[model samples]
Target: MGGKHSVLGNSTLNQSPTIENIQAAYKEGDTSRAQELIKISCGENNRLRLEKHQLLSVAAGNGDLEAVQYLLKEGRVDLPREPTDENPAVVAAYYGHEDVVKELLDSLPGTNWIGLRRLQELDVSDNRLTEVPACFLHCFKSLRSFNVSRNKLKVFPDPWACPLVASLIEFPGFLSECLEVLFLNDNQLEAVPQSVCCLKSLNELYLSHNPGIRELPPELGQLSNLWQLDIEELNIGNIPAEVRKEGPSAVLAFLRAHLRKAEKCKLLKMIIVGPPRQGKSALLEALQTGKVPQMMQNETSIRTTKWELEKPSGVKDKMDSVEFNVWVIGGPASMSTVNQCFFTDKALYVVIWNLALGEEAVANLQSWLLNIEARAPNAAVVVVGTHLDLIDSKFRTERIATLRAYVLSVCRSPSGTRATGYPDITCKHLHEVSCKTLEGFDGLRRLLFQVSCNIKDMSNAATSQKLVGRLIPKSYLLLQAAVLAERLRRDLEDEVQYLTDLQLEQIIEQNPDSDIKDYEDLQTD
Candidate 1:
């Protein structure tokens, strides 16, 4: 239908494509003429000159969904060892051939063309796929040398490693021994996957052009069969010029040397202390950016959020930035000691009060201050009053003034029940805001940053700790990765409760990261 501008111009439309004619059609990419020629050729010759795999690819690229569906009805189509530029269904999607793509996607699961026991290879090099195609996962057991390079895929493809697909794969390590070569170059991968190390038989790996690759996995050196490992054009800052010049072998060897014995993150625990229905959740959301997760209707006690606080420019140099592990304990249940084991001296306690409760707000604030004193008396506390937007214009100023005066009295460290070790509780600053209107949050952030600048963890100060940079193991984030992996496993199994001390220690010690040397030289901070 795309005019009679055929590759074989002036030739009859019903004429079958010769081997040379089909080759010419392929060079021109996909067009209606290619589809017409393919239809005439298939109708004339049951077995085409080229392999079915090649034909299927070209047919899909030509947007001939009928031909693709017919060809796939035959038994398994295994990709040959040699690479081909024409991607079977991926090219259809890449060229915006929607019908062909729809046919491939719709037929993926039920077709049974690719058997679970067989080994198939695919090369989908230049399709702008942000994620791995469903064909990759469905063909998990069948793939031998899968390639999804030069795409927008940020995640590594290991079906067994992913919990959602793990259950579907009856055998997890099928690809480990089978896969020989992998092409993951020119993508958005953040870090090298240590899981790739499990592919013991892997020979050639292409990881060049990924600018987001900040660090290499330490266990990368353990790949015994690796001969061609490419990291060209990556944006790694720490790699030495000499190592980079020495080529892939030298770079691979350098991975083990880069293993960190220690790692540290400038992290603080910021506790949100307030009563329920007082905008504590909303204020926490706006302040630290940690989402106050929706709790089950029956269970409402505590929620934890990780807030990364960037240091303002022109602040003192030694301390650049810090992460705040914001612990939001609101609702009627979390005020009790049983729910507040997160209290610490190194934390910034943000005590919020509801302005709706006039005098009772002060009583609630006092009750919270008492708890902070009993547990972490020396901790920096910032008092906040929410619902400022609801206050009448005439009364708002007086209400704020009164609250500010009360906070000033508390900052003087009034005499209270004196514990032996705990110091006098003091509120460093008082601020009022409305979570709904987002008023006074910028000033609140500045106050929080000021408190963070001076506050130091007592334990970190006492010890002659040298490597704050190397505490968690820097060169590779596998230690942090192991912890995260364990957390994911727990979440998947619905084991959301805290683990025992012994369990946590075992997880760290064993680590499951080969580069850490069984973490024999482990130290606590």
Candidate 2:
């Protein structure tokens, strides 16, 4: 305890707080003396003349947790709604008294006293807190505005880790769904967490002056209510300068576009099926080196040669810049049966045949196309006529046209006249290519790229649908779990006066489906 002169020496002479006796008691952390002075001032005739800030500020700033708790227990003081120079929460945070800060926040009124319903706004700025207190989420249940600016924090607090947030499943109104403003400026944050995307009601987010943040998670675009985002002095280089200049709406739009592109850019599985020596491998070689293999000898491929086609430069659309995962099945024509395992509705089926064999080429093409269409009913097929350089130049034009028309007639949809009932194979395209001279190779490559882009787009759309379908069930389960847990917690609290680790484990073992077993396991260590 300090001397009476030492306690009151810094206060104004006329102020009630400067009264020598009370000042000395509070300054010396004497909860009993302080309470006695409070009772005298708050006597029946004249209520407590002491200011709540006077007692709270000194106790909190001095890290006197017990004295602060005593004052709160007396029920004579209430937490300030807005932080002022003498606010206890502010003073506690400023002096790094984490326990005192927790006590101030937890003392609010409610069944869940730590909830934010009473305290709508909190500012703990300029405090050198290395991390946000874990109790923050528990204490600030309905908080609409929060600021933790100019702190040494490295990561934002995770709402999921907070017991109050978990309990919100039963009391939806107490959730952070109303939170509208947040300021996290001048911190050491390196990456924005995906958990922030759950803040659907968040509108304004300030994250300026954080030099280490290199990129924002695209999931952040899921914050549909967000209208203002500030990242003024971060190291994020991927965001376009034009978008950043236009502001939040433009930045959100840009992020959405990139997210769509990422979702749509699935690998295109291109399966090349043909007779043993119909230039399937040669086409792959030509696409890789851009040069035709001259006078290639006929060699049977014993297994599949798998390779990928890197997207060429200058391709703008993400759909068009797909990387083709090429799978060329080799060996005898009989091996085509085993190739059915690789057939996928999302793949591009290329059926090649040696056109130099004349009329015999039609049968080879039909056999391979029908086999693939049977396994992959919705797959896109491209009929490629190979060995065109071996055909006589004079007859090439007429022969190629005749072959194309015949193939189209065979693959056309069955109508009133054509009742053969062959699988309705709508060929994507028909083209002739001389692997030796590389005559029509570029056109073939372009067509494959276009088909691959279309298939990837469809796959992305299906994936998005599945994700949305899963969310409804997931949300329902989460709400159910919350309700059940709250009910079980009440039951346990009523049965036992005090909860310990061993007691909680025994209760969980008795009620197996309480869904609290995981928490007990975590506490075991």
Residue pairs whose backbone atoms clash in candidate 2: 42-48, 114-139, 116-141, 301-331
- Deviation of model 1 at 21, angstroms: 99
**Per-residue accuracy of model 1 over 188-212 as CA lDDT, tens digit each:** 9887665676777888888999998
Q: Residue by residue across 167-206, what tens digits does model 2's lDDT show?
A: 2322233444777888888988776644565677889999
- Local accuracy by lDDT, each model: 0.62, 0.63
RMSD of 2: 17.5
Find the 10 residues in a row with the least total lDDT in model 1. Answer: 462-471
